[model samples]
Target: MDVDNTKPKPDTVTLRWSYSPITYFEGPFRFKENNCCWEFFDGSATATINAKYPVNKSQIKNDLNKRIESIFNASLIYNHTPYKVSEPFMEGYDSKGNLWITPVPINLNLSVSGPNIVIKDSNGNAIEDMKGNRLRDIEEFAKLSIKYSGDPAAQAILRNYKSAVGEPNSEFCHFYAIREVLTTRFWSATKVRSCLNLKKDDWTKLGKLCNEIPVQQGRHQGQKYEQFRKATNVELEEARIIVKTMVKQFFNYLQNSESH
Candidate 1:
């Protein structure tokens, strides 16, 4: 009988990945819990996962990507600015210097495009921005998204909100879809508005802008192309702000209800 001498593969591994552009949150922000850790800095960000058992590297990458998405989504919700992170370059290895995964070059160039609104105090010092206290708010909102991850309605609203952020041409339609998600669940515009604590005038105006107007960006596909006019930036911005407020209020209501 021949004895096999091949060493068994290790069960434990550590995976690390980095992505950019760095989040708007003031950093270096660090989180370490549940076998996962991450750090966000001004010009760089990295996340790590310590797996006690064998896990797929691709799955780790996907999870990290979703986290990044949630962070960006939180940014949009709070700052009314659409931000995106580049695909993370990931690698995995064991304690014995055995490489389980190879480092992939980050070839994608992503930009953090938004107004860095800074408030100045008396004299010549920058007082506040979207960082300090706002970072805590963004973190809380992102965690709320994770807490409500099981609810279909909440997920739909988040998905539509993200889509609206990415699609500048059809921004109003996507934002309106968020309201539609609520209306579908509640089955009444009034009830939906009441639940979200939205004003009647504001809700009606949003609907009118998306459904009644003959804009090229209108939600209705049946409208003739020649009959539609482009929606102005002012109209788009108004829709974005109103929808953002509605989402924030809705999330707050959910958080409050869950606590009781």
Candidate 2:
């Protein structure tokens, strides 16, 4: 419960289950942004299993001791901290004083229940039932305004758009989305950097265009849509067109590249 933020973050955080064949997870981290639960991804493939609950020392040694292997049937392990191992069923410290577990497998068809630590396969539909898999079966709604995952820049753009959707001005949010996508520093910068489609010149030009969109002063400065519009004389429709065009161009580039 008492997370020492001062403690260094782990080099990597991973979740594993008894049946998993691979040890690493890349992410969807569908839980509340950097929280206890994580959704991991690998390239275009994403794993839906989220260790949606936190498990500490007491729960593990107490309730989970007898069912120890079951507890570890689904576990979340962090590389930096040796003192902790969290499982879907329970979390706690073991006598080893270090995480001895190796990565088992990566599976997109798996889903974990937060409170009960139930394992569901791709066939299970209900949250409480463990007979089916939720992640593989359900149609994943676009968390971002537009679900564009072909590359990192597009993903960053869409995620920023999802975050800014409820703001006062949709146009400003769209601008922010464009800025984040083109900035090449948001979520997956490495992929964005290597993207041949979103070149440095393109990034610089987009950033300069967005710069004229003034930001607000003071506390809620990020919510600078009003001032941004007034100062830049940019219209909502224009912003939408820019974003849509970029999205289209990125996908088109991908198609062309793959054909070659």
Local distance difference test scores for all models: 0.68, 0.35
Best by lDDT: 1
Cα misplacement distance, residue 138 of candidate 1 (Å): 2.0
Model 1 misplaced stretches (Cα beyond 4 Å): 1-35, 42-44, 53-59, 79-87, 91-101, 125-127, 221-227
- The candidate maximizing TM-score is 1
| Per-model TM against the reference | 0.76, 0.29
Output the lDDT of residue 11, model 2: 31
User: Per-residue alpha-carbon lDDT of model 1 for 117-164, expressed as tens digits?
Assistant: 678888968887656667667777777776666678877888888887
Clashing pairs in 1: none
- Which lDDT value does model 1 have at 60? 74
What is the overall TM-score of model 2 with all chains considered together? 0.29
